[model samples]
Target: MTIIVAGVVVLVLGILAQVLGWGAEHHEAAGHAAAAHGAAHEEGSSVLIKRILVSLWHSNLFFLGVSTIGTVFMAINYVAYAGWSVMVKRISEALSAWVIPGGVIMLLVFFIGRHDIFHWTHDGIMDKLVNGKPNPHYDEIIAGKSGFLNLPFYVIRMVSYLVIWGAFSWKLRQLSLQEDLNGGTYWFHKSITASALFLVLYAVTSSMAAWDWVMSVDTHWFSTMFGWYVFASWWVSGIAAIALTAIFLKQAGYLKGLSSNHLHDLGKLMFGFSIFWTYVWFAQFMLIWYANLPEEAVYYNQRLGGFEGRYTGLFYFNIAINFVFPFLGLMTRDAKRQMIIMKIVAIAILCGHWSDFYLMLMPATLRGENGFLIEIGIAAIFLGAFLILFTRRLASASLVPVNHPFLDESIHHTT
Candidate 1:
């Protein structure tokens, strides 16, 4: 209970601090832009406002669509695979719940800010052509792809993903609970079967989700590894989140039986996955860079050219923060055991997630301009909502699965 209170306080204060700080900085920067561009700035402001609105809308849509899918995955998995993961399953279920209300808010933000992000929302804009040719950026490719990308199909896919993910998430949770009551090997076997089924479904749906949400922004450039890239990011971040939250809960007198061994395992996974994420990121970039194909190169070109030094700097920094830090910090068994050290590494992992998502979204969303309050504001809103959901869900169940067959194994687990 106190843990929840503390989280709320921290969230409020942190958001307040960030909002005030970033808001002021953004205002000042906007003033400079206005001065430099003069009246043209006013004219551009109209366009900028429109663009921002679109961006906000698209962002909201993306979040809602993805969160629903994620939540569904958890729900169904809960029903289907209630055994093998009965112990560690709550971690993923909690995250699925986190996405629910947060997803709604994200959708609202997208609707409200529609003009800022998406080009397709413009009226009759896709029909226009340049020199008897439709502009690829404005209409041609995206428009052509609209058979699949149009609003209706888009919503349909979103719903389908949500249904699949939510079912999996819920069922997995349900079956785990059922096993506690029924005490049957049947449940265990069923769960294993379900997990296998869910994994295959997850692979396909997650890939499409990534393509629609992130990769489509570039439109022209496509990488086969993108889905895996996003999976690496989310999977690592999700594990890190579980670790951080688990640590917090344990500190607050929840999850009483959890031991340092669990923490050590979590730390090791975090370290390992961080490296995995780096590998995927590099593989994608290297292949594209080496090929130097116009389609592939354009994506990097936009980041390098549009963002100037910031994009490149951020690219390297992501590697260092997400990969190098973990590699060095969590390598020692002693370090993982030390609460203070674990806290710092945990915080780093969280920030790495933020940066990872930022890179995923921003280079494609903003292109050239420095990120501003709207992004921060939207993120805060999502974070607050997620925290609220996470804490509530955490409270609704036992900190650890008391009836899990592996409970003894996990408790006794040691090097």
Candidate 2:
């Protein structure tokens, strides 16, 4: 906790330095722009910074959303698999710590920019007087989902999801640490039970969240596979995060007990999940394409529209990077065991998923194809925040599960 508090302070200062340093430089350049051509060009560069910041911002929010969902799912997997992932579980749990604050910021962003992001938040447009009674512009649809999609209800649902997932993540992590100290089964049993309960809740909340956050952008569209599709997206992303973190820890001289076997396993999972995600992607695409139903086809049409070409390109490229590259790159047993090879694939996989999510969110929100400064800024801030938090948490504790009965199993993690 002390580490977190101190790290937050340092991070705030770093962000402030960035803002002040860059802002001062821009202000001075702007003041001189009228006097010189070079100065005017320098002023143009500030636009670039703004665009970059926007891109970072959007990317960061996407990461926060995916990572939070991944944390909850990973915890659920720990219970369902009934095996030890104690070695990497801390990394998963830490991924979620960013969710509460991230979600709050996102909510603020949504409300502040409601006109830009959401069509339904307007009283004059979405909500209006009809037949002497209030009727939303998207009345029929909104009426159908009034129970779940109204602002008040939406806030409550979102809070419930966050609170449940956050509580489970913190508690499960506490138990894992407690077990390490007490060397008892009691904490383990409790953790397992709590994880089980959380898993059931996670499924429901994850589906709702995917719908609420992403799917609702196209309020008229609906798909039963949407939830599972999102699951596959973030599951692959989360696993890649684990692999990347594992590699970093190995290089930094922590988790030295974790051998190449663990790397191989993590790499293999990344490879396999990439394939699984692609399968889900193609399955969803193929069905909609072949069916040719107007409503269903609208989703693709909007995605493949002229305004969304770059996103579409990334959408397909995500397949190549996530599925093809990893499939070939990690195919060999030897390759999966090699840390360098695994890290490269891990990066590719993570970037691919990031693009994958960019496809999911941006097109729906911006209603356009290309990313911008706002997106970049958001992504950077969130990425910086997570890196700071995760690293600090790691530094404060032992990397290995020192008291686990299967700690040896994880150390050797052999096939």
Candidate 3:
């Protein structure tokens, strides 16, 4: 209740500040214009609702990715037969509680704000040579991608992805609970098979969803590594969230079996994935920037300074917050094992990734015209709602996996 109320207050204040202080802003990406020399131009109209809708979409994607990745983290452990994470796996399970809400919010945002969020959603944007003349609404680039980007197919993909992910999360949690009741390998083995299948399916849907939800915002720019980039970002954020929650539970007298060794392992994951995310970011950015192809280069140009230098700071901030901070703060093994440090770092990673998602859509859609108050309010509401579900789910189950095959190993896990 506290969480929800605080979020609502923040949201109301944010909306008021945005309306009374900023007033109506331009519809087009604030600082963007037609790209020159074969670069595709993204067009926009002045829609007042565009701001909130984009903010909502951004938050929805962030929470949804983290929630899905939580299940993936647990599933990957099951697939690998890892023992060290048995104590903390429940944290991941709790996160699954947010998947449905996140998906619903996703569908809601897409329907309400499709036109503002995606340039391709514009009517007739995919038509070619209408009436023997180039159609005024024709986008040659978008038209070429029309087969996959059409509305019916797009809706189908989003709906299917959510359904598939929600089912997997539910199944995994159910199997875990059943394992506790039966105290046998039956559920465990079933989980391995289920997890293996989910991973294979995830490998495909994760990337395609990234293309649809995020990369499409740019309309003309695409990257081969975007799927991996988004995955790595979400993975680190989710794990950080898990580790942070575990630390809190430990301090609050839950997960008494959890030790510094477990904290150390969690820290290592945070540190390592932060670097992995950076590697993908660099690989994607350097390759595109180096190639200097008009279409590809213009993508960076928009965020780098093409838009009156609005996004340049954010681009670097994303790197520093996600990579540099973690790299420096968690370099020492002792740091990861420290409860306070772990909590602080986890909170930082969460906020950092939120900003990362912010950059993903804002530069292309909001054009830096977004207000932080509203964005923060939406984010806070998401965190509160997710916590409401996560904590409820967490309390409803045993914090410790009483019958986990590796419960002993995890309790005694050493880094």
lDDT of each: 0.62, 0.66, 0.86
Off by over 4 Å in 3: 23-47, 129-133
**lDDT comparing candidate 1 with the true structure:** 0.62
The better-scoring model by TM-score among 1 and 3 is 3
> What is candidate 2's lDDT per residue for 12-125, written digit by digit as tens?
554555455544443353334322422211222243343333344355556666667546655665666533465776677667767666666666665555444444444434
Candidate 1: worst 10 consecutive residues by lDDT? 37-46
Candidate 1: stretches off by over 4 Å: 1-88, 106-115, 120-138
- TM-score-best of 2 and 3: 3
Ranking by TM-score: 3, 2, 1
Candidate 3's TM-score reads: 0.94
In candidate 1, position 350 carries an lDDT of: 68
Positional deviation of residue 87's Cα in model 1 after best superposition, in angstroms:
5.1
| 355: Cα error in model 3, Å | 0.4
Residue-wise lDDT of candidate 1 within 1-415, one digit each (tens)? 4444554555455445544554445445444543443231122234345334434444443334333434433434445533333334566567667344544454464455433444444444455576788644355655676677666776677667656666766666676567777765666566666767777788798889778666765655789999988777676666667677777877887776667877777777788888888899899999999999997897777556433444777777788998899889999998777666777887887667666666766655454444534444544555565666766776776656666665666666675
Best model number under lDDT: 3
Evaluate residue 353 in candidate 2 and report its C-alpha lDDT on the 0 to 100 scale: 74
Per-residue lDDT for 348 in model 1? 87
